[model samples]
Target: MKESDILSEALVKIKNYIAANKDQDAPIVKFRTPADLDKIIHFTVDTAGVSENEFLDLLDKYLEYSVHTGNKQFLNQLYSGFNFPAFIGEIFSTLANTSMYTYEVAPVATSIEKEMIALMNSYTGYSDGDGIFVTGGSNANLIAMFSARNRILPDSRFEGYDRKVKLKAFVNEQAHYSFDTAANVLGIGSKNVVKVKSDVTGKMIPAELEKNILETIARNEKPFFVAATCATTLLGAYDPLDEIAAICKKYKLWLHADGSFGGSLILSDQYKALMKGIERTDSFAWNPHKLMNIPLICSALLVKKRGTLQHNITDINADYIFHDIDEIEDLGKKSIQCGRKVDAVKLWFAWKYFGLKNYQKRIDNLINMAIYAAKKISDHPQLEMLVPRQSFAVCFRYVPKFKTDLNQFNLDLREQLRKSGKSIVNYGYIRKSLAIRLVITNGELLEADMDLFFKNLLDAANNLESKCQLELEIH
Candidate 1:
């Protein structure tokens, strides 16, 4: 077969896999350690490349061992499923093989990326503001942090942090770890990233934020930034944005909304209320790969002021490559890195394919799914919720009878589900206790899926409990 035939076969296999999530026999993830995977697929280079048939065989083996993220049973991460239209656009972009940094290289892709940023900014209330797409949510937050650093202490960009001021920042205790990473990367140190107290629901308490800022100031530290989480990772809670905005305004701090996990609330009329006062933020990070259901690595950083992202104002021309043109058309300036991918095309095409109304409905449906799961968890005698449901993730724990060390037993149950290829979920300790975090990110998930999740969970618990009791009997 020709290479085209092989490509066609591979694409068809992928398309079928994307649509075959409902297949019960389909594995969520095939368990293999590093040693096992290394044995299955050797990575040593070959001077003479493998033939088309060999490549096809390798693809088959790769798919057999890979985690099926689009599978209905898969509920392990912030992004759960696939978007077909977005995937098609991604394939097109991949074939186009163009970078989006400059119009000279990829005019159409650069245009789409700018236009997509404009669309996102329109909703974000950035009047004359601008935005750029980073590789992922983490980088989006980091860029926002740098922008804040540059704008807050304008001299720091030139003189560096030496002898200027003790720069400090704030985020809720439950905010993404990217904030700590940002602080460390910016030379502010993670210790300078003051973690304000969060409420029982994992929402950052605005009053506590004010108190922390006061304490930091008392210690002669300048608090320059505050990040309000839209949906925390574990609890999926939205921090009180209105209260935080007031505090930011009083302190003259840069307010950033880390909306990577829950920013689609902007599209929903009813659900967007969770993110009320979001427009007042100085910068915002939203990941379409998450709630927007776009493909991976589509994240945007939006700034309230248009020119805040301009790091270098000196006119240094590269006439041989890029002429002085519409700066708006050339996104390479706003970006932190060169040779950026055409990440916006897939998201723009996906947004246009779904339109605003349908997308809003999808967000509403996802929120409803979380509510449904929360109700199920509440009603089930064998399950216990760790916190109130604030967004599309329901964090809970399996309650076993006789009250043995439930965390380990629950972990065993999760392993059973994994081994059986019946369902996939995640568990970790939150608030010094083990909890299962299930995010409702799959657009195709239904009440029936929730039922299946609960059923499998119950069966696993029963079996594990029986084994434990048998062990006790032997002892």
Candidate 2:
């Protein structure tokens, strides 16, 4: 078969896959156990290459089994929905298959990344800012801590980590687990990353933070970096950045804001107050892949000071790849990676298609939908609101009429919904109760969709309760 013919066939399959995903009746995921899937799909990698017809059949099977994350019902993860322009950019970048380390190899992509960093910096209030596209939110947090470590203890980079002197960092107890991984990776010790206290709403208490700092200092330990979570993973809580910044300033510590989940709120005039003191932060981590509806792996770490990344990350001996050129800007100097993906192109394309006005509208709409979901849960007698809605995550659970284990019921209900392909919402614990975590990250999601999800959830609960009752009677 001709190359053109094969390409055309693949495109046709892609179109069909996308169309099926958008269908309201279609399942978000055709759930299957690993053993069942392994038995069904051909996983063998033979020495011989397959024919074009066989290859096309394989593509069909792949699309048939894969989870449709772009579906409207997909609310299981932080990221959901799809953007066509960004999809095109993803395809083009993959086709080019070039590294973003040098200007010569990826001139247009390099320039586009720089533009994206600048654009993100403007919202961060980093007038003289610098940034680089990283792998994910976790990687962004890791790099943030790494940058802080290098800046605070410059000797550690060259002379190696001084085990004699203990260094401590702090974050809210509700903060992402990535910080622990970061501490471990940087040799800071996971235990040294103190978990500051948070209030009922989940925001870190400034007084508690200061108390922890004082305690660490009393132990004669060096308190270097403090991370203020912009929006926590489960609760979607935003820590008080202004208050945290004041404490960090007094202690002369590097304050970094982890805005990986809620950074898109910076585009909204009304909602941006959640990160009011973002400009005061030394560094900010933003993931456009999350609420912005961009493709995955589209995250950036923006530093307030210019040239900080290059100074901290770049090696003096890598002359083979990085020539001492004054005019050209090579991104490798700023990145922790040697050969990074062109993550910015997809984000840039999405931004261009939506523009600032439409993007702001999207953010506003999603938040509104979240609020709507919260109110719906509150009004329903059967539904119990586990925690107040903060940003886009609504934590709640269904309350049955008869006496039974609420936690187990909610757990089974969530799994049943997923298995039946009715919905794909997630769950997280709110103290003792397991609340269903309905994240409103998809821009295309509507109020009606929210209603439908609740309806399906209630229906699942009814059927489950009936089956359990019948089993009990039989026993």
Top-TM-score structure, candidate number = 2
Residue 412, model 2, lDDT: 95
Residue pairs with backbone atoms closer than 3 Å in model 2 (clashes): none
Give the per-residue lDDT digits (tens) of candidate 2, residues 1-475: 9889999999999898779767878887788888888887777877897888988888888888888888888889899998888999999999999999999889999999999999999899999999999999899889888888988888777777887678899999999999999999989889989999999889999999999999989999999999999889899999999999999999999999999998889999978999999999999989999999888889999999998888776355777888857699999878878889999999999999989999999999889999999999989999988878989899999888777899998999999999988689999998998999999999988888888888888899999989878877898
lDDT of 2: 0.90
Can you list the residue pairs that collide in candidate 1? none
Worst 10 residues of 2 by lDDT: 310-319
How would you encode candidate 1's per-residue C-alpha lDDT over 1-475 as one tens digit per residue? 9878988999888877766666856677788888998999967779999888888888888888888888878888889777888988998999999986678889889889878988999888888888888888889788888877877777777678763478889999988998899888889888888899998989999989999999989989888899999998888899989899999999999899999999878888988899989889989999999887788988888888887776623243656655766654567766777788898999988989999888888888888989999999999888899888888889888887775887787778888877777788887777778888888888767888888888887888889889888888898
TM-scores, all candidates, are 0.96, 0.98
Q: Kindly provide the TM-score of model 1 when superposed on the true structure, using C-alpha atoms.
A: 0.96
Residue 95 CA displacement from its true place in model 1, Å:
0.8
Regions more than 4 Å wrong, model 1: 312-317, 326-328
